[model samples]
Target: MNESKFFWQACRLLWMSGILLVLISWGSDVPVSTAVSNISYATTITVDSSRDVSTSLSERCDTHTPCTLRRAIVQARLLAPAARPVLIQFDIPTSDVGYDASQELWELEVKSTTDPAVFRTVEGGQVTIDGTTQPHGRVDGPKIILVGPATGNKNGLIIGVNASGSHDNNIVRGLGFQNFKDHLTINSSHNTIEDNWFGLTSEGQQPYLRNDNPQDGSGSAGVVLISGAEQNLVQQNTFLAFDGVAIALRGNDNTVRHNQIGTNALGLLTLKQTSPSLLCTPEDWLGGGGISADGTGHLIEENIIAGLRQQIFAISTQPDAIWVQSTCTSCTIQNNQVGVDAEGHEVGVCGRGFYLTNTKQVQVIDNVLAETYHSALFLNGALYDANTLRGNIIRKSTPWLIPDDSPKGDDAILRFTGLPDPLEFFNPAKITHIEGTTVSGTAGDGSPCPNCVIELFLDDNDNINEALESVAVVTAKADGTWSATLPTPLADGFGLRTSSTTAQFNTIANISAGTTVGLSELYMPGYVGYLPLITR
Candidate 1:
């Protein structure tokens, strides 16, 4: 391939790797060398202090002279164009005053201005602010904490603006950002934000509570990518406890994968601040949520979102684990676990799994959504075309199920106001029988559109589809008949259910009513003495 082709391919591969795997750790930083190989010049700037003070432009970030984060950022921006890129590492002492009285925490306090305190604009791209170089950066969570001021709106960092697209390929990794209006705002492209903790404490155990005035300084969000910011990769990060959205995407073609939005790093515990009196007032969280996408062509996959719910006094509006607005066209949200933990168990409180309103050409596939108090899949607003929901396991949580205030029938999927054809979007699939390994289903009992795919799942002792594992997948014939035999026979007394996905529109129907498997349903084989006989 040509050099340009090779470069683009390498970048694509790098993005895929970032989306699929944890790209960085405390021992190593994001591959600045490998990512920008074409760049001839580079420099390293080491920050030794956790202070937010600026340094002279002429000074170098080396030993003998103290280098602050603010100074390193400014110097990197100035040197970035000529140097091509700059690596900013940390070397702050654990005993510095920046550390708490217990000496277990280290933070840099940036006073909030009219807008948030932007450490630097990151003029030239390819700048890496890696906190993994700090003393306890090797720990499971972040070590360097960037704390906002007591009052006023504070923003942790901003990268580039729309006017100038020079800021690209910048990276912010292994840091803890708390109490910022929008922790990190990006307007540039090709940037990677990985392995960071937002709205959480340095240890990543719980939400950061502002001690100065508990009711004040609640941040609007953790990360906000402006409209101009496209093709950015936000992966392997933890977002929780923000007053509003955790990650708000207004850009196109960004990929948010493997991120823990509302869950801990292990994807087990919820990091939401439950107490209304201690933090901001109860009114702050009305309709607040996990992830909101208003951009087009974005890929949101492999995220664990729970935590969101109706806060105190917020009766009418409920939060969603993931919200896709009308502007987000041609987006794909797949393999995500909403209202459920990494182990597929219902863990946290979520109002809805997905709230898609007026979205166009969006695809929701292969996601597990459970334990939501409201509808698991809610589609409303203007008429949208070519939107699809296929193979998603959405069900109410059994045993630990939250009571649904507004019941939209027994099914957890809800559709209203300008939906597609009923068979394609509103109708539920039907399970005729589940005999032995073979399972049969109907798409609305042989509707006009009969060609579809059916998926069978072992229900969790109820009519609702709770289990994440699908037992069988079968293709429905043009006559609306579908059957699939599993590898092993299903046990008697077990409840089985199926869902349908239209071949034409690719829309999935609500899960069918649970049918109990019977003992007589097992396929019997004839045997002669000790020899087994196979019969059709």
Candidate 2:
């Protein structure tokens, strides 16, 4: 082809590709111009405390006029995607409702009228409800929102208004959430819940969840994250009496960092027994521990846990400060302080600092845990490479502390049994289903690796590394399986299908070229953690 002709052809190809990208973008609910328009007006709406108020439609909310917090949220939603973000700011040191702000401390309440009684709901992207407006707050000053030695509201702040902000930025910061059944329940991704207080009234009173089951200490859904919520920042928050499972996560890659969690209850929780994939309600969240987490690739770090158990004001079982399950793959719980000085200050009411189980490549490192009823760290049945458990400090509480020290068999730092070796290969499963020219699978142990990748290579030279002749790449389902069709369909053998995300014993399939694979011939790579053992 002539130079001029070739240049035009290349330009046409580029133009067509750009048009295709635009079409794909247009397929979504948001348009580029719409998002740009939203970038303009940073609408700051204010609320005057109106108790039990709600918004239906055509209700107006803005700084010029006064509206309830709920009504402001409704108005914000209406103005979003055009404004891109709508900030909800609390009025000065007081509200229209009788929230006596006599001492520079402002307060309000969101009582539950709904069946499960949620205080308020937040959704959408790029929305911020900042309570720190200099006078009301400071970067390094006293917290202004107070509960005045009285009680707080009844429910919690639900953060998934029908799955809004599932992929955008939504932030709630610097507010004191007190006496709610649970503090914050987040079911969206990339949201930030930080620099806030939970479980304490304005006057720094411990807010107790109406614990229905005191005997077992099971009640209240602390902070919850579910519905595939990923990469959220829950940081620098404080919790008072409403601990035992202060935060519950049922999602992937959500970060719980730099928060002051735990007062009289376990700090954080993540369970799969009742909660499952792509589903889990805040109501389904279980209580227990400062960090009771069960998921893949979560980073829990630098949080202070003072008392990882709910005293219940009665006889009850205490939980760990940090709890991890085996299903948690490559999760790191690190660099956290879990106790205080012996002057009636410390974490764990006879509870462990770390209780880990069924975890994969989990690291429990560099935590100072004291004043516990049991071992500081307890490990049971999980996959651990050199990456797990190092540089930790465990010591007994001083004399005259509550919960008489059981120094006999449980007051140690590290305890483990029946744990899986890092390189151990066990019951791993993968399933494949054909969808048009694409193939997908759910890949992992019994649990799921939600956003796992699968790669197919045409080179079946039996060299796992060298077979880089690219074919196709596919992602697994929420269940951790994967499938990908070859560049060309073969009957079966001589191709390779591998879980691109692998451990020491990564699962890779050696397809019989010219032969079609159905479910799979579960791979047994030489080395799973990184490179194949053979190559090494």
Candidate 3:
């Protein structure tokens, strides 16, 4: 058959199949026949529901006006996965305002309602659930997108991997989620989950609400990617204030980069059901937390973990801000920080920095750890052949101090040669400029960290941990005012981070945008703590 005849035959076949299709030329603006089976199209579904099916909306809902999130997802799945497939956009009219004061956000609260009523499932392979269409990203405005069940046992959003993507190729971006047990269960690969707030506020800075229950349920996890979730990018999202771990990565070969990880009982967790019996939350959580990477060949780089202090017996317990355990052999954790208050006062506990248990050949490089009860990094009985640990900075109180007095060394790095190898050069570089630097700042709550040390670092291309040295270190006064007069060096940029010893909160600020020689009052605005200058 000639090309013209083939085209007409294709068109006739698609029309007979009765599938709604729109075909456009791949290279030009010429109109193509989507009625042909060779042509695939795109569908856009708009949601306007503030309530889940359990409340007021219809489940198994159509892809028409007054749509719900569940309906949009379900309708999108109807069209067989295609190259240019469906898009689920939002025009959600929310009743509640968000952290910002000028924006009106969209909210989806799921509760006591699942299946039958609305056939609650968001099934898709080539679908994009974009929440950016609404108002978002303002300190006191409304959340542009919010999805969570208010009162029921509804699991948030369960997504299956795409048919043809390298790793989570599906897109779940620019949205806010809360309340439901687990926010997202991404079974896809090669997808991008960027600019979203999971278990956090619309601004991705503070926790929308703190759901801390050590009792009834497993609490909630922001995102849970099961096995086979390879090469996916989970970045720039806020995993904060959940009852359980923030991110649980059961997959392998993934990259989690440049995200603001907030305080929860457990921040990030990675594990396998197979080998050496990993110790997670139920095991007293002393093994590791904040960011747990226990998968093979994973990269967790340049992330900030703040306000993640777990309470024990009414006092804050020392937990690993980053846990590298299980059989996560050959994983790299670099330039991550704990005990960071974004260059401000202490609001977070800044618990134990890094914990490495039963693992081999894990590399931990260029991290800043401060204000911990026990030690910065801990290693257990599992170091055999070759492992590299270096370029880490640590500041902490004596283990024999009032609250943390456990007779443990208040040392910078706690090594179990059976595990950790903090080489002499990689040992904690003094964050304290005891003689020559002036540092002053208040807490996130407008107070000062009493008797805390201030450290100033030279910012080399924005990396202040291993790339820069401590230019100044000073102790804070009773009123939180701290200063040290030292000769200033001319450098490209500078990083200043401060934390209190007695107080659990922390913050950071950078002098990169300051005068050559002037007072830089850092500001970290949030509840727990931040590193506007951990500057990470």
lDDT of 2 by residue, 322-395 (tens): 77866677787766767542122433333666776655567664566655555566555533433344445444
lDDT of 3 at 195: 49
Model 3: per-residue Cα lDDT over 1-536, one tens digit each: 12322332343344224333344433323322211223133666676665544343333346344566666665665655553466677665444332223434555554455442222444556567766555333322224445443442356666664323522346776667755566677776665565456655443333554343433222256777777667667765656654456677656777776555653212332111112132122333221135666568877765667655332334545445677767677787876666553333222333566777766567676676655544566655533223445455554432213234542343344444443232111111112233223433432233334554444444332321222344555555655555555456333244443322222222212111110110122222222222332210
For each candidate, what TM-score against the reference? 0.77, 0.58, 0.59
lDDT of 1: 0.62
- 82-170: candidate 1 lDDT, tens digit per residue: 67678888878877778764435578876444544556566678888877657553345556788877642667788776525677888
How big is the RMSD of model 1?
Answer: 9.5
Off by over 4 Å in 2: 1-41, 50-58, 62-65, 93-97, 115-120, 134-154, 162-167, 205-219, 263-288, 312-316, 341-348, 382-387, 397-408, 411-536
TM-score of model 3 (CA atoms): 0.59
**Highest TM-score against the true fold, candidate:** 1
Poorest 10 consecutive residues of model 3 by lDDT?
510-519
